[model samples]
Target chain A: MNFVGRQAFRGPGLTFCRLLVARYSSKTGSKEYIDGLVKGKPVVVFMKGTPDQPRCGFSNAVVQILRFHGVENFDSVNVLEDEDVRQGIKEYTEWPTIPQIFMNGEFLGGCDIMMDMHKNGELIEELKKAGIRSALLEKAENKD
Target chain B: MGVPKEELEKKLRSELDPAHLEVDDQSDGCGAKYQVLIVSQKFDGVKPTIKRHRMVHGAIEEEMKSIHAIQLKTMTPEEWEKLKPS
Candidate 1:
């Protein structure tokens, strides 16, 4: 398993530095680079296209799942934008798929797992652990 | 060019020994896309979902190279039964 596991919580300044390295470093798609890309982010996805206009059905499904949870403003990497990243991510995670989701720097599974987790309420629990309160929780509370 | 459904099925059956398996080629004649459901003991017991997926992907590593997309539903028999019962 190439699972990166959960990283320790980081301060905003340290997170900013990691993001900067992820964005500006020439070694795009390297292990260190991807680590930086995901580190400290509440949610991140390496998908086929931008979240607004996902090129693939699976990627679009992931976008919808997060949206239903009222999760916006998450980081997204369009693999189509960079060939190195396109291949590098598959090798990095050793998982053969696009639309890979990460939560708190841990590689959550792909589209199917996202859907499964959403269905089983695990997604909400995960977001809560990341200190994100899902909008669904609010809706349920409002119903009560 | 995509892989033949039978070949993909055979590979997964042999590799994972799934209790229940369904491989659907959603790409019509071209065979580029697939939706696979595998219910197996291999997916059971404290295994994270990501690891379960990796097990399936690893089984079809070669076919995965040429395939454009795959939608996978991997679960242990107990999990599968809860979601879909006879």
Candidate 2:
């Protein structure tokens, strides 16, 4: 892990991370761990690691994309930091993978889908359609 | 014990006599969520919602009782041919 990245999750003895790991590691308990996160954030990402310190390349891709669009307020739930979140998210979305993004209480798919939408400008379109009021898109347009 | 893929396939095929069926075992080793892409002549001019889902519901009968979700990609064979994934 990056030194700065480790510092990003220093609170609560990093017990939150450990709990997440344990949750995904086991099979049948607190399955709603992921649910609460999604409900907590209008834009929640269940990814390989945290946003500022993505542990995997896929999570990095999403972080980069969002940063490119000036999206800084999104919350990322690190899947690697928690096992229950890792497995339960897959079960919840039935997508069997990581780097999943949820927007306004809806599954927005993974990197491939997000990148595709981003590249084709569909991501902005859909985000607008979903009424996200993304300062990211506004900022991107302003800079352009 | 759960509604297996074979059961899903059989239930759908017998009910719809679909031109083609793709019943994915998306249980992710736990047997719950499934992603199905089905093409049937019976759905030649059907609405996207009813065409894709009700067809599966009609076929699965009992399995739909448990499968929490079904990501449907329903189309007529002609539509499927057009979307042949290049």
Candidate 3:
């Protein structure tokens, strides 16, 4: 039984290891993943659908909020892009939801958490941490 | 919009292999809330913020969209007993 228990764990451990290796071996390697990701870039969102076509309200809300911030330097990836990365990211980031926000390579929590932080001014603080400062240019333009 | 509890329970147990599990259907009430209590070995080295919740969601990825808010109280059995020592 103990051996079975240990083997049960070893299975996933081995699986995770093989995934890591395969993740980096092909021409479509970690760099491609990184390139596809906005890790070192500005504000990047990995979402269910797209900013214009969010599959869920949660994704839409976050995208709308970012738009409100007048932060135009945003990039987005459709998590539905690759099924493996979509599922693997669930394991990789340990976040269950789409519309994951990353700022300069830092994980910035999920939609609800981000909404709370953005409501409380911490979103701007996090953005500052990533050297982002929102001028609300869109707000200004809309006003005019 | 709500899934049958028995089906959900069976699927969750089979998929996530939890050490503990609980489910409440509060869809008729405010927030469309469902309270889930689950403890899984998969969460042993995972972060507390969402480890158990995600495990459950992954197990029932299809249901999350329909169920509005799920109040999750995920813990190892050791922690579950401590928290619910009533």
Candidate 4:
């Protein structure tokens, strides 16, 4: 009661409320937590929804593009589930969008970059570098 | 409410001084969605694709709050020339 009132008087009540929300939502939104989550993953997508059921078209496109390369096992974090994560990821990568990709724990840009890489054959080359054989490669070999 | 296309164009023009620039309002006249193609010397030494995107995002950071999505194609003038059907 007094604590809430004091915090409200100190700043905008909205910031206090948001801080409370973040405090109660576990520490998953922390930069260190996200850093640990991506450190060892070969491919990770911080997107709008789960890999199996992406909510946004851009996120869906990311999932589908990875699927096109036969990358089904990559990790995915649905930003829609947690507001903190949704905001944290944007700040972490300094990219202002959903559907952010990280390859070998490195920020790989957003869906547009993925689309460009897919079209330019860079996605396959990148997957190879990450040690994940793209299904397209197998299909091309079969055609030979 | 959403931002006007001309406002975004003006912002990009002043910030990037792009040699070639295209801004398409993908959300009809509503202005919530946009696709931008920018070819500027500002991107000449920026190698990473994400870094290029960050520069554009930085310029229009304010507009982004109201806009839902932006499909950006950012490149140096030389890179854009190679992409042209010549």
Candidate 5:
């Protein structure tokens, strides 16, 4: 009897076992979990990597922009670790891209939108409306 | 597997009736990425950048599935006119 088939079977079986565990824990679904995460935070970014070591340029750009605006505290979810959460967030927000931003539980746009808003001074205004203060104004005032 | 730039342009044209539209295939022959600049009256009075993006994304939701990335710039006709050269 050949052991190759049994070895292959074992590999797949192990993977299946892990998948079952993931599914059970995520039973509430990624959408609900994502909603819960974004509900309380004034600013939440679902990005590809952690804030300090962003894996993607788009995600890095967002982090820098937020920092430039003086936003010191915000939640960041790294989607690279979980395939389900990565895909689930796209469906949850109806947005096809990563580095998505949510403000006050509302789906904000991606990096491009953030850059545009930042250029037009809309980002600062939106932060103010949400009761979050940015350091951009302080920098401008200090410069004057 | 990938959406053609022309197909995306057609969908946006029909839905938004943009006064000015430019769709560039940025995927370097893969046809998976695109950049669009659209100016339309429909965007008038649209507050916030996210809402405007959602309007554009809504118009091409089906095609979006096949697209890998979309860098979109949306503007009102008046804004477009201002940016236009004399």
Candidate 6:
């Protein structure tokens, strides 16, 4: 991850500089870059596209599931943009496949595990364990 | 070259010693993707689903490099028997 936050580019002339740095950093394989992104966010999804516009069905399913659980704010990295990061993440997690999910710097499995956890009510417990409160669970509790 | 379904079955059968195993090549003619169902004593104590997945992945780590995707359904013998229709 770039040490410079997006907020730092509020200056008039710095927007272009940020874009340049983004392009430059992605060319180099930086495990630190990946680590920084995962460590800083409570929930990190390394998927094919942004949460708003996922490039694949599996990625879209994960984004929708997170939304259904009322998790609105989370970090998403578009793996399609960077080849190094794409391959690097597979090696980093030792898991084959994209749309990987990490919570509190721990590897949770891909879409299949997410769906399984969601079905069994384990996902809500997982979110709470990571210090994220789920509105879905809250709604269920209120109905009781 | 992509991995063959028989190769994956042979690997999992030898490694996990599964009581039942079904390996389906879902990649059409390419043999690049697979859907596997395994029932074994090895999965009995594997707590989380992800760890169970890791055991399967580890069993076929070499073949996994050439394969595109693996959709796995792992169960202990008891769980497998419970899910059986008859």
TM-score on alpha carbons, each prediction: 0.86, 0.50, 0.52, 0.84, 0.82, 0.85
Clashing pairs in 2: A20-A82, A20-A83, A21-A82, A21-A83, A23-A84, A24-A83, A24-A84
Q: Give the candidates in order of lDDT, highest first.
A: 4, 1, 6, 5, 2, 3
Q: For model 5 chain A, where is the 10-residue window of minimal lDDT?
A: A14-23
- For residues A1-144, write the lDDT of model 1, one tens digit per residue: 121112113334555555455457767779978887888888999999888899999999999999999998788888997888888898888888898999999888899999989998999999997779999999999999
Q: What level of docking quality does candidate 1 show?
A: medium
The candidate that achieves the highest lDDT relative to the unseen native structure: 4
Worst 10 residues of 2 chain A by lDDT: A22-31
Interface RMSD of each: 1.0, 8.7, 3.8, 0.9, 1.1, 0.8
Write one digit per residue (lDDT tens) for candidate 3, span B1-86. 56676766787789878888887877654324566777777666666344455667778887665655555655666766677759
TM-score of 2: 0.50
lDDT of 5 at B15: 99
Model 1 agreement with the true structure over B1-86: per-residue lDDT tens digits = 79999999999999999999999999995678999899999887846677888888889999998888898888898989898966
Tens digits of per-residue lDDT, candidate 2, A1-144, equal: 464346447635444664455445554225455555666345778887688889867679988887776577677777775566676787787564567888876788776567766876877766675555555667767898
- For model 4, state the Cα shift of residue A71 in Å: 0.6
The lDDT of each candidate is 0.85, 0.68, 0.66, 0.86, 0.83, 0.84
lDDT of 6 by residue, B29-82 (tens): 588878889999999989899999989989999998898777788899999999
Candidate 1 Cα misplacement greater than 4 A, ranges: A1-25, B82-85
Model 6 lDDT per residue over A18-110, tens place? 345556775424667667667745798999989989998888999999999999878777889878888889988888888899998888998
Instruction: Give the best candidate by TM-score.
Output: 1
Ranking by TM-score: 1, 6, 4, 5, 3, 2
Which digits, one per residue and each the tens of the lDDT, describe model 3 over residues A1-144? 474456457555543444454445553224455444555666878777888888767678889888767665576656674566566555556665566788887667667656766776777777777777755533556799
- Model 3, residue B16: C-alpha shift (Å): 17
CAPRI rating of model 2:
incorrect
Cα miss at A12, model 2 (Å)? 15
* Chain B TM for prediction 5: 0.93
